[model samples]
Target: MAKLHIAMYPWYSFGHMIPYVHLANELAARGHRISIFVSKKAHSKLQSHNLHPHLITFITITIPKVDGLPEGTETGHDVPMELNHLLCDAMLLTRQQVEEILTADKPNFVFHDLAFWIPQVTKKLGIKSVCFLVISATCMASGIKPFREVTDDKPLTEEELTTPPPGYPSATVVLTLDEIMSLLGASDFSGMTKLHEGFTTSMSDCDVLAIRSCTELEGKFCDYIQAHYKKPLLLTGHVLPEESESKLEQRWADWLQGFEPGSVLYCAFGSQYVLEKDQFQELVLGFELTGLPFFIALKPPVGCTNIEEALPEGLEERVKGRGVVHGGWVQQTLFLSHPSVGCFVSHCGFGSMWESLVSDKQIVLVPHLGDQIINTRLLSTDLKVAVEVKREKNRWFSKESLNEAIKSVMDKDSEVAILLKKNHLELREKLIKPGFSSGYVDRFVQSLEELAN
Candidate 1:
């Protein structure tokens, strides 16, 4: 296949951009020219991940300020979920920037997510637009359909969302009522279509549809998408993070080394999603109850300036030697590979889900809307590679539920522990098999070439 130039513009959040860069690196490594649209600050953080800098380039785009958005907000990470639509508004305003770049560069393809109107832009320019989703295919399947099929303005209701859409894969588990509610309310930003409609429009408008996932893991979901939408689809595998020459920070390495191998728990939610103070304390209290050495790299609770202020009154002192809580980012990939880190307690974002899947650790997921689809799939009886913390009717979990979920995987003698560990290890081995991810990339590139042809 001839070398192609692919321009990617993922959502402004760090989680979304980082995964795009991972895929960009894979494509660049395959001798393709790649250009990524990013804000200067986001590019600053992503610079180190550009392994093939000679082939990959960054195109700057401006984020227009919306009324509710803070003055300097260039990414969704800077704001609470309630204000994300404002970010989306800002993303839409970059249409001129995107079109000018596309007009100037005349790339073979432009890959996008979050820009639901991207198809409208590419169609006019006669560029092949790929809606390469950063979210799971399952999420796409249930929430989206052909944009032309919708004849009414009514949004998908909670009841409809809780069950798989017609022609969806026969997965035994569907979204819980709470998750469905979260989804319905997530995009409450005025002047925007509902989240489900947005996804439907995105997939419907694209020339080629691709997911940051693999057939081995989500083949049925991918099939459902291709058949349902009648659009050519591609999978980029998990686009696993490239191995880093950087090591874990010295302080964290020393602390983790003191624990027995596979004994400590590492917990992190991605950059977004701040817990309420009560919930943050509940989460820490749960970690404390586990009595296992743990490191928590999460944002401070809402209403607090930092993690230190949000820590429960005595949590630090009680877990003094065994626990540390930090608010800022850390080397998540390197920490996951550490020998002493035995288990992963994740907020279950797509990137984290893939990271956890590729690790040897026991998996425990606490799903927010961001990953409810994939998280449910992993914990379903069909796969059973991980366990989920039980939540109350209001979708809140007690410290005990959190504690037990961790300890369930920690206890070697328990039947559930044995099953989870066995299944997780076997699956991880399969996913990381030599060429598993790269093979997907190869086929994905072929699909792109076919589209261009």
Candidate 2:
């Protein structure tokens, strides 16, 4: 096979860029020369990951900032008030920078994130641009369909998705008007529509499209998307490497020495997703009410204005020794891999769910917005690996419901819960074994090589 030179353009967010880079590392290990096009901030994080010597040889193309977004305000959640204007400007600017790099370096193919104008730019250069849909393909297929058909205020009627979607065998998980209104209240639905428009165009135009999900988890949905798009759709089945058992166990030992096995509930809502004052308080109360030891990682909602005060009244004092409230980043993949962690209370984000599954932990879904609700449905209904929390009138998770969900996941004799535990562990074992560890990634690289041939 000929030597491959691959270019990867990742969005600034840690979640967006990390997995792409991880894939790059995997490809590089197979003797491909990789070039990563990313923002300066993302480059910094990549450096921090302390990549292996062979991977470090991969080139980086840094996109300059359109405006000075504060140093650490780099991720999607850190969007400035003038986000759209800045983003559109950055796209054009990055296009020039990316073109310059491609002209000089001449990579065999390019990998691009869904964000930015990569598909448009790469096409102009006559390069094969492949898009990696970082989220669940199931949700992408469902969400983008409305954009293709819905032309105006006449949104998707209930009847359309109430039954099994014509293309997919699974029953459609329909959201009610109340749920829609609830999501609209907290989220920027108009902005979301625009985002999907870009996403759909990228997927349609890219030479290949891939997602960071497993076939076992989303097989039917993946097939539906491939059938609908008639494009190469790849699933990398959670491309995560297992940490050394000794190191992982030691880290858990420090935290879980005195705690009972399967007695501590771990609550982390991923890198993005911030909570409003009320929601944060409800979460605090829920963990407290579970009557189990817990560890929580708190992110100061985007601008970091008055986060400490956002807590419930004396809630910190209540859970003192029995719980933790950490901020900034944590070694989350490591934390999840720990033996003492019994259950995960998560935002149902695609990345978080996969990590929870790979770590062999059950989930208590508390979806805030986005495709999270759909992911939650897949977890609860399709995978039967988790139970969803009930919502209040506004469809937000309430303290009472969260408390109940926590108790249910931790319940010892719950037949379904026990079965879920057994299944997730089995799945975890399959993923880490030699033929499976890099199975999906290896296939993708092999396909790229075939294209070159």
Candidate 3:
């Protein structure tokens, strides 16, 4: 095996970091030297995971306070929107520090999350840089196509929101008006700043692109990106562990022993997404009304006070033994795959969707910001494997709608629901087998081996 050194810069959340670490581990298994540069907050997880023993090294890079960013919060998600913008606005200022790190020991390649000024930093180092688009390749292609239009000074008028992009399945690859606004920052792009602007430029100039998704799921989009950009497009599948069926059964036996099979609706919104006080209350009432056994794995909004008390009246007592409320993290993959879980109520984040889809479980899509809505639409409309809840006033959803959506999918007799479960199982098996996503990961490793030569 060739001695190759690779570095990765991950987003500041568990979902993003977890996949980056997994990819790093896979690369390390190929006898490559890997260093993952992470923020201070993200450092704890890598340390706690004790991943270095698996053959990858962790490098902690501290982003000093600059341009009004709080001393402790390094990544955008750590602080509120305003501060996130402040830090991103100052991306140019962080260039010096990135330069310093690159000067010390430049790796053969750098893999960067789509945050910060990654592309700019790579160009400065004269090294090959590949963006690890951790989300679906379809979303990446959509983002890039619109970006090209925007860069050419042909800003898509507000009317173009409904018009589907040519050469893709009808409505399979479309963005809504609100989504378009969020992307263009009509309502003050809470996540945009000078730093973001610089970073986008870097992505446009990157040497290669890799997404943590396989062609089996996004073949059309994958082919489009390769043909349009003429750059090597790499897919690493979902890169999650293939937990044995027996292993999952035993774990479920421990946590879901008393609950009825296919009765409990598992609700988890992933790491991001914060429900306003009103919306949170509505959800609690909706769950209670459904009267079904349930489990909620939540990382509450960063600063919510006394989570149990925050629920609607009598919600905690009614759902008492029948419900489980978790504030911190848990093994979601294992939990979702449990036979007791009838359906998944998710924030529609890619990771959560992957867990739900790969487990062959019915899904209830409740999306918030970022690529969430796009993924939800893909599942609900294009994939026909999920049920979606309509958003209210572009803000919050109602309890009644939420309850109905849950019931519809949880009802096994419903043809759509039954079909979804079967389709998901088939898709899951394909992804795991040779000549599919797992195969893609193998190909990626082989390419890296060649690159090292």
Query: How high is the CA lDDT of each candidate model?
Result: 0.82, 0.69, 0.69
Model 3 reaches what TM-score against the true structure?
Answer: 0.87
Lowest summed lDDT across 10 adjacent residues in model 2 is found at 180-189
**Candidate 3 collision pairs:** 89-194
Candidate 3 lDDT trough over 10 residues, lowest sum? 189-198
lDDT of 1 by residue, 161-194 (tens): 4666777675665666556546533544232234
All candidates: TM-score: 0.92, 0.86, 0.87
Residue 376 CA displacement from its true place in model 1, Å? 3.9
How many clashes does the backbone of model 2 have? 0
Per-candidate alpha-carbon RMSD to the true structure: 2.7, 3.8, 3.5
Tell me how many clashing residue pairs each candidate has. 0, 0, 1
lDDT of 2 by residue, 306-379 (tens): 55666667978888778876665667776776677888888887778777777767788888766678788877
Between candidates 1 and 3, the lDDT winner: 1
Compared with the true structure, model 2 gives a TM-score of 0.86
Lowest lDDT 10-residue stretch of candidate 1: 184-193
Q: Write the per-residue lDDT of candidate 3 for residues 107-222, one digit (tens) a residue.
A: 87888754446666766777778878776766656654342234334644555544655565435658767775443233443343232343345456677778887766777777
